[model samples]
Target: MIPAPFDYARAGSVEEAISLLGSDPDAKVLAGGHSLLPAMRLRIARPSMLVDIGRIADLSYVREDGDRIAIGALTRHHDVANAEVLQQLCPIVAHAAGQIGDPQVRHMGTIGGSVAHGDPAGDLPSVLLALDAGFVAQGPTGTRTVAATGFFTSLFETALAPDEVLTEIRVPKATAGWSFMKFQRRAQDWAVVGVSAVRANGGVHVGLTNMGLTPLRAVGVEEAVGGGADPASAAARADEGTAPPDDAFGSAEYRRQLVKVLVRRALEEALP
Candidate 1:
């Protein structure tokens, strides 16, 4: 289907993009155009203008910041998957980034775009949640940081305001013992159920994908593990708080069962 007619403006910097978005209430920011373009083509999104930020070169980088790894918003999945910094410090993130879609999508899709899109089925969000990442956003007022725990609000919803542009993502550098498990119908397809597990501080952090309105932490499973339950026992609670969709992939009950098995496998692999 043809996308609705819209004016296009390229932003030379983050400030310019924010100004363009603020000036036009209906303007959508375009990064890699992986998420927004598809929505626009389907008529699910009708914007009067598209503020392109692809030319903002400063927003495409990966560096170490004190105790965290700073990733710019425009960094592509292909870069993230091969980044030496991410691979050495956070292999789970690199592995998940490499597995998103096929080569074409990974080469064009940006991590910031994936996280900001707030799609429950997106692999990166669940991995970011497990890594306890933080997002930086810039708007007319200035920049602010939002934790992954509160970044996702609902289905296709996020904490970012209308004129806010996500600038960077910050993830801790000390995480280890990580595992990312994805269950899909075919190669390059969205996951039927996915689980991300990583050791943080002293306990395990677990995030579930496609099991709720947003990427969700498996708190019930975490609690069980904290209480000294075995991997199988902790995984039994993987579905305790989720409300998965019943659609073409699988029923809610089927997802519930899948989560248990996947969580168990993930825990067995992630735990020391």
Candidate 2:
């Protein structure tokens, strides 16, 4: 399948990308294009123009900022998976990133693109959610930060405005007990059910992938854990507030059960 014809403009900076997006309501920003290109190829997205920001070299970095690790929007998955700061401070993020797709996809896919794409099944969103990360967005007016808890709105949708470009992701330095579990049928395949668990703020944060319309926090499990429930007991509530999809991959019931097992394992690993 071929994407519908569209005009293209390469943006040299975040400001220029935002301007290009603002110039046409139908314009779409192109980062790594891992998510957008697939949708375009299937004609699910038919933007009138593509604001390519791939050449914006400044947006590809991973650095330490105070107690947080700042990752530029254009930082590729490969880089995120191998960044020394992320590897040491937030190993869950690096571990999950290293599991996304294949080598080619990892080298080309950007962390910002994955998060901004807002796919419920994406590995990073759930990891970021579990980490309670912050996303920096630059729009025509100015820049603002959105918490991970509020970043994802719905399936394939996020809080980012049409004219806003995600600039950086900030995650706290979480070097304590953490675990990322992804269950897939084959290597490089999307997760059938994924769980990200991290010890934070004296409690456990749990994020579920492929369990809802958006990357969802396992509030039920978290509450159970907070209430002194054991890993097995807490994980029993993994499917309490989820709407898992019934597809070829697995039925909603299967995912519901799988999440319990995965969450239990993740909690066991992530909890002291």
Model 1, residue 91: what's the lDDT?
85
1-272 in candidate 2: lDDT tens per residue? 99999999999889999989999999999999999999999999999999999999999999999999999999999999999999998888888989999999999999999999999999999999999999999999999999999999999999999999999999999988998999999999999999999998878999999999999999999999999999999999999989999999999999999999999999999999
Clashing pairs in 1: none
User: Native-vs-model 1 lDDT?
Assistant: 0.93
Task: Residues 158-268, candidate 1: write the lDDT tens digits.
Answer: 999989999999988744698899999999998999999998867899999999999999999889888889999999999988999999889999999999999999999
Q: Residue 198 in model 2: shift from native, Å? A: 0.4
How high is each candidate's TM-score?
Answer: 0.98, 0.99
The local distance difference test score of each candidate is 0.93, 0.95
Give the local distance difference test score of model 2: 0.95
Best by lDDT: 2
